[model samples]
Target chain A: MRKIKMIVEYDGSNYHGFQSQKNAHTIQDTIENALYKLTGHKIPIISAGRTDRGVHALGQVIAFETEAKIPSDKFYLALNSVLPEDIRILNSKEVETDFHPRFQAIKKQYSYYIYTKDSGKTFLRKFAWCNSEPLNIDDMIKACKQFEGRHNFLSFCSSGSSVKTFERTIEVCQLQQKNAYLKFDIKANGFLYNMARIIVGTVVDVGRGKIKVNDINDIIKARDRNAAGSTAPPQGLYLMYVEY
Target chain B: MRKIKMIVEYDGSNYHGFQSQKNAHTIQDTIENALYKLTGHKIPIISAGRTDRGVHALGQVIAFETEAKIPSDKFYLALNSVLPEDIRILNSKEVETDFHPRFQAIKKQYSYYIYTKDSGKTFLRKFAWCNSEPLNIDDMIKACKQFEGRHNFLSFCSSGSSVKTFERTIEVCQLQQKNAYLKFDIKANGFLYNMARIIVGTVVDVGRGKIKVNDINDIIKARDRNAAGSTAPPQGLYLMYVEY
Candidate 1:
């Protein structure tokens, strides 16, 4: 069997997530079904990240083994032809047998978008979280700085995550505004379960004056899930990239 | 009775169109229902434009007569509190009794987006039309210039429009590239049915080298619907703004 690597893009609105679940629609299941139809082979597809329901992805990488007769370049077109309009195979190429999408991923970048306009039209509601309340950017920026270095993010993670290690290094944490939107771009070697969402929730709390900027450090030191902010909604989060 | 002008935003995915259709979901129906819940009166809403199914709107303007006791400035919050998540009232204020959303409108702007990237992520699928081939912007710009000013746009309108006059003034027509996305923003005094979408479809043909730039004038002169390009999908078209 030959291993093939692909870049994927999808609308997560109708999907349960990236992984397979019984009776639920998933990005993996749709792509795998499409691949099976194209090559008449049942292949196991692995992704770099398993995004939650309603969370979108761009540059998401996936790898699968196949014995199809088509060349590597043709796989992109072939798979895209069979995929749904909401899902797309961006690029496809032959990869070394040992190459695994998740195992080989060295870093991941995620972006969270919030529309701070007093009102947004219906068109942008799904892609962004509309916050009519004016947020304090200075206070939020100060709170975000506390998450820049290595730390145990257990307090920021949601419960039911099976990760054994909660300690991870954040390479970069940057926030900026564009037009009426505020974007949070965070890069790290690894992230714990719901870490980015919880981070945003905490930052929003700071913006709302519910928590002080320095409260971030105190929350992290507590190592308790309840000590951090609530989990922000999934609509605003996007998996921007994965480096392998 | 007070005439209130509202700047509305809505996702058209679930609606038949902006108008109230028989036994179909519509933006008008949704907003009217919400307004009825807020004020126990059946208020008729007049809008600046009527968008098709799967279309989206940002700054659509509407006006309605209501006897509700809510403050004019608080209309945005009051209506939004009762509206569904897909629809939002961005701004509201008391308008003169003579102010009518459709008749008093000075201009309207619409934008069509195309994804010309070879591959794209999942997040932008609903917001743009994905084309595998790269577009020729130079050719498209030349074609767009031919469409400016007042002329008979009969060839560019949708199939079922019954408007008597086909003359409309195109105030602004421009195209821009944002990352891997190509967007066309056009402003006009009025549109003849699906004029913006048809213009986008024809220009896209020029960008794809399927049609010559000079053919736009011929299509306009021909005054036959078949002479123009295909009607683009509704998903990529947005009612950007409606001005009074």
Candidate 2:
């Protein structure tokens, strides 16, 4: 058997999520079906991240074992032929049998988009969030800087997540405005359930003058859900890339 | 009574076309419904162009008379509140009673988009054409220049189009590449049925190395429908702007 590593991209608007669930339409389920059609394998496909509903991905990594003799480059074309138009395989290669996407990943980066104007309402409505209010980008950028470095991000995570620890290290967080949109990039060792959305909500509140930039210190120290801002919507977040 | 002239943008994936048709969803019908909901006026909307099915619009102009008490500036927010997410009125202002979207227009511009890569299948799939083959954009740009100036474009016009004449002057035909996409912009005094699509198809043929850049001259002189290339798909075309 040969171990195959794949880099995938997807538009996740209509999918339940990246993880496979019983009786639910998902990205993993779709890929498995395509794999079964190509290689007749009923095995699991492991991914680096299990993104939430309506969350997009640019370079999501996956690994699986196959006994088929098809070449690595040909799998990209064969899988795309059967996969839906929203899901595509960007690259495929053979790896060692012990390779694991999650354990080997050193960092992951994500992006969130916000559309602030009604003028440029082209076909991007599905990819970005539309917030009608004017935002103070200077304040939002300042708040984003506070999210850098290590922190116990318990308040930034969802309430019911069953995780071993609430501590994680953030490598970088930068915000930039492009035309009518506000885009932010965040890189971390690991993320909790809805952590990115919660952080964006808190920073957007800073942009709106509801929460001061310095107040982020108290919110992180509290480590309580109610102390942080509300969770933003899911459609705006994207799993941008993973570093090994 | 005030004649309101508005600049509109839309994603035309789900609509039959820009013009209102019997028992069909259209951009005009959607905007008219929003107008009725706001001002209680059931009036016809006159547009600068009647785009085909799956054809989008960026700065499509429309004119209609209204007696609503709402100010012109606030109409943008009011209409957007009720309009579907795909359609938007970017600008609205009261114009002279004699101003017309079609008759007063000096020129119209259109754009066509083609995606050349197989990776990163995202929301843009609904807005562009995917061609897997490698394209020669430099050759295509040379062919684009041949399409400029005044010409009797009977061969480029679709059959069964009842027009008084087949003569139109082209101001520009420019091609550019952005990442994995090839985009072309065209400006003209007027267009016949499927004229823009047929021109795009011809230009794409040159890029694919199927036709010579010099063959366009003979094709134009033949005045036969069989001399020109097939009409490109409607989804790749956009009515970019109307200059009035």
For each candidate, the DockQ is 0.63, 0.61
* Candidate-wise lDDT, in order: 0.87, 0.89
| Candidate 2 residue pairs in backbone clash | none
Best by DockQ: 1
Q: Residue B206 lDDT in model 2?
A: 89
In model 2, the runs with Cα more than 4 Å from the true position are: A39-41, A66-69, B1-3, B33-42, B65-76, B95-99
Give the residue spans of candidate 1 off by over 4 A: A39-41, B68-73, B96-98
The most accurate candidate by TM-score is 2
Weakest lDDT window of 10 consecutive positions for candidate 2 chain A:
A117-126
Which docking class does model 1 fall in? medium
Candidate 2 whole-model C-alpha lDDT, 0 to 1: 0.89
Instruction: Give candidate 1's TM-score.
Output: 0.89
Candidate 2 CAPRI-style tier:
medium
How accurate locally is residue A187 in candidate 1, as Cα lDDT from 0 to 100? 93
Q: Compared with the true structure, what per-residue lDDT tens digits does model 1 show for residues B1-244?
A: 8999998887777789899999999999999998999988888899988888888888888999888999998988999999998888888999898998887788999999888765553555566777757678899988888888999899998878889999999988888888888889999999989999899999989988888998889999999999988788887888989787
